[model samples]
Target: MKSLSIQEINTILNGELVGDTSQMIDGLEQLKNAQPNQMTFIGSIKYERLWDSSKASAAIVNENIRIEPGEGRAFIKVKNADLAMAKLLEEFDPGPPQFDIDIHPTAVIHETAKIGKGVKVGANSYVGKNVVLADGVVLYPNVSIFDDTTVGPQTVIWSGTVIRERTEIGAQCIFHTNVSIGADGFGYRPSDDGRGLVKIPQIGNVIIGNLVEIGSNSCVDRGKFSSTIIGDGCKIDNLVQIGHNSVMGRFCIMAGHSGLAGSVTLGDGVMIGGSASIKDHTVIESGAVVGAGSGVMNDVAAGKTVLGYPACDSREMLKQWVALRRLAKN
Candidate 1:
């Protein structure tokens, strides 16, 4: 582990130090598990008890939170403790050598593939023919990039993820383990025989923008006509399902287990809480927040907050909740 003095940590985090600067912090650990040489962070004041009992050399905390450690442990105060800790961890862990021109010996790169400079292809990964991987892309073990797919620079794909043919992923995107992009959309027609279903050919692709993070086990289906477009800075939580032809605008957040039906259009900064479902062809405007477990059946205007099985106005939902509580008491 790389070692840095308390002063250096403070400088790196831009936090104000409350103790000796010369003290060295070799590594980081959880607040409850940190030892004398490790640093920990107090992300919330609720964890004050843990901070008080922590044997850590130093702690990173918010500027307003004041805690006195019985021992002479140093305190580094910042605007947001959690954010500061994130920056510090990035500095300490500085993941994988930034530039690796070498592909792992076990990786199978097709002869027609075009791999750019500084790309790292891990063990057992497969890059199909005509695939284009730009610079600084990291493919973890078991990742499968199919033919005609193009991954932009600096995209990191975790293990077991599969990008189907012709998918285009933008730069700085992060795909967690088990993500499946460009899978055939759920479009089946009843066959004339009446005993079987006819599968439609998904000739379209998926276009993912920069800074998008798709969580583990999520699936984004390709369209039957045009592409399923996910705009920049979108954050998709685990187990979510994005149907074919869905267009998600910039900075849209979709929580765990949520599902969007095909052709849905989500405007910029739309926030969908856990397990929510948006019906097909629905348009949710910018800054709209869909509450957890809600099923949106209609178009939502910008900046609206909706909640319920069939989502209604947030204020109306609260009123109903209050009434239900009172009725139950009666």
Candidate 2:
């Protein structure tokens, strides 16, 4: 652990310093967990009362918050304490493991595949025919890239992940373990004789944009005729399912276990909480928020917050819950 003076931390965070500027901080922790050599933060007003009792040598707080006078601890006041904490965490992060070899000899690469400079393929990985791995791409152990797939520069795909045929992943993307991209969508048509379901051939692929990070065990399905598009800077959490032909706008966030059915359109900055499900053909407008466990069957307007099953407006949902509670009490 590297120790930094309170003055150095203030300079890094562009914050105003109070108390001892020479106090040393070696790590960052939550307010309740911070030690004397560690820094903590109060990101909201709700936690302000805990500052005096906090054992941290230094604390990061919002500029607007006034701390009680004569506290022994040092404080760094920033415009946004939450964002400053994020920057500090990034500064202290020890990055992921770096591969020594450019390409492991145990890896299998098809004769027709084009491997770019500085690309690293880990042991037992398979790159199929006509695949294009751009410069600086890293494929960890047991990764499988099917025919004609293109992985852009500096992308890292971890173990057990599969990129199916014709999928296009953009630059600087991170695919965590066991992620499956471009798998066939859940599309089945009834047989002409009505005896059984016929699987619809998924002819299209998945297009993932730059700076996207897909968490472990998530699946993004291939479209029947067009691409399932994940836009720039989108962050998808673990175990999420994105159905075929769904188009997500830039920077949309989907939490763990959330799902979107076929052809759903999510506008820029839409946030879907854990376990939320959006029905097929629905449109969630920009900046809309779907609360945890919500089942969205209709279009959600821009900047709206919806909650509950068959999700309705958040305020309306609260009112309904209150009315139901009153009736039950009676």
Candidate 3:
């Protein structure tokens, strides 16, 4: 654990300090959980009231909150407490997992594969024929990259991740444990003789842009033809499912359990809340926000906020909620 005096922390945050500046903080914890030697942060007004009850030696507070620290405790007031905390977390980060080795002896790489400089392939990882791994790529144990795939520079793929044939991944991306990329999309049609179903072959690949981060156990399916694309800086949470031929614009965020049906399109900066579902071929324009548990059946215009089971405008959903409450009171 690293310890820093209150003055040192304030210098790092570029914030105003109050109370005992010499006080030492060894760790950071939540308001209710901090020890006397630890610190906490009030990122917003909701957490300000906690100052009276918290026993922490110091706190990082948002300047807008206008609250004083308790008598004996110190406070570091910053422009945005959350962002300041994020910066401080970098100082305390434990760093990467203990892979350490450049390339483990147990890994298998096909002779046709092009491995770049500084690439690290862990034990039991497999790189198939015609694959291209760029410089600084790290493949954790048990990872599998199929034929004709290209992983860009500095990308890190965790254990049990499977990147299927012909996939294209961009630079500095992070794919967490058990991620499934470029698997065949869900497509089936009625048989000509009406016996059962005929499988529609998926011949397309998955293309992911730079700086994307996908959480554990998420799946991005391949397209029917061409590419299913994820643009730069998109962050996909755990258990999220992106379907065939779907195209996501830059910086889009999809929370845990959210799903997109085949051919769905998301414009830049779209935010999909947890468990939200967008139907096939639907268009969600730029800056739209879909609330948690929403079931979007049609197109959402730019900058709109929608929510609920059959998703509608956020204001309209609130009005419906009010009407239901009145009925229940009767």
- In terms of TM-score, which candidate is strongest? 3
lDDT of 2 by residue, 1-330 (tens): 788888888889988887774558889999998888899988778888887777888888888777742456788888899999999998788787777787888999999999999899999999999999999999999999999999999999999999999999999999999999999999999999999999999999999999999999999999989899999999999999999999999999999999999999999999999999999999999999999999999999999999999899999999999999999999
> Residue by residue across 73-92, what tens digits does model 1's lDDT show?
78888889989988888888
| Highest-lDDT candidate | 3
Where is model 1 more than 4 Å wrong at Cα?
A: 20-23, 69-71, 97-101, 192-195
lDDT of each: 0.92, 0.93, 0.94
Question: Sorted by lDDT, highest first, which candidate order results?
Answer: 3, 2, 1
TM-score of 3: 0.97
For residue 239, model 2's alpha carbon misses the true position, in angstroms, by: 1.2
In model 2, the worst 10-residue window by lDDT is: 64-73
Per-residue lDDT of candidate 3, residues 74-121 (tens digit): 988888888988888887777888766788999999999999999999
Off by over 4 Å in 2: 21-23, 69-71, 192-195
